[model samples]
Target: MSRRRSARPAPRPLRPAAERIVDKRDGQWFVRPITGATSVKTYTCPGCHAPITPATPHMVVWPVEKALLSADAIDERRHWHSACWTRRH
Candidate 1:
């Protein structure tokens, strides 16, 4: 018998900016968008001027928020933009 794969819509990508309004050992309590309305702390990428987004579960986030952290926190200091990181083949 042959099996067929179902076509599910690709998930919405993460937001360009998000903040850890709440931090815990488990994870962020609440992370909202980084917009001009609020004083969202952000770092500009040296390479692309595009805002950097966080690396998060592709599933947990639908129209997700970018995770920002101290440069020392992540394995690589290189921050990623939602579009840049979520680039599909």
Candidate 2:
């Protein structure tokens, strides 16, 4: 007896590139767009020395060149308020 195979749809392709931001003074930072569906985490802003509350929408930044490993660098990344980050200069 011949068995029939069930057809499955192809998986969606991953994003080609991630959005990144580069600040001459601040080095580089990766941009992460957070949808409302995901839980938001709070962080302290290094620029203004203020807290970045959850669900507020902000930026995550890390040094462009560091001696630490990538994982460690990411771990050292800082969260900042969008406006504050823009006026960081």
Candidate 3:
């Protein structure tokens, strides 16, 4: 009698490192880079107070804290131009 062998499972794909944590004097910030291909809407940059048009590559920043809830963090998030975010003091 011939025995049947089970098939091996497919390996999981590795996830990209898309988000980073930045420590500033004010607080710990979670920054995510938005690629032009994925940016779909316009946003006002808090750093320069200018409009970030659709398809523009930018950074999205939000403060992180033990006491801060997920909803609050989302509400506090801001979109900034890459240059402006880098230059923010």
Best by lDDT: 3
Clashing pairs in 1: 54-67
Which regions of candidate 1 are displaced past 4 Å? 1-39, 52-75
Better of 2 and 3 by TM-score: 3
Query: lDDT of each model, Cα atoms only?
Result: 0.39, 0.67, 0.85
For model 2, the superposed segments whose C-alpha errors exceed 4 Å read 1-17, 31-39, 67-71
Worst 10 residues of 2 by lDDT: 30-39
- Candidate 1, residue 23: the lDDT equals 43
Candidate 3 deviant stretches above 4 angstroms: 1-17, 66-71
Model 2: pairs clashing at backbone N, Cα or C within 3 Å: none
Query: Sort by TM-score, best first: what order?
Result: 3, 2, 1
Identify the candidate with maximal TM-score.
Answer: 3
lDDT of 1 by residue, 1-89 (tens): 99978699779885566543444344433333333343334555434566543433211112123346533333233433434433422
What is the number of backbone collisions in each predicted candidate, taken in the order shown? Answer: 1, 0, 0
Compared to the true structure, candidate 2 yields what TM-score?
0.60
Better of 1 and 2 by TM-score: 2
Q: Tens-digit lDDT track for model 3 on 34-61? A: 9888789999998889999999999998
Better of 1 and 2 by lDDT: 2
Q: Sort by lDDT, best first: what order?
A: 3, 2, 1
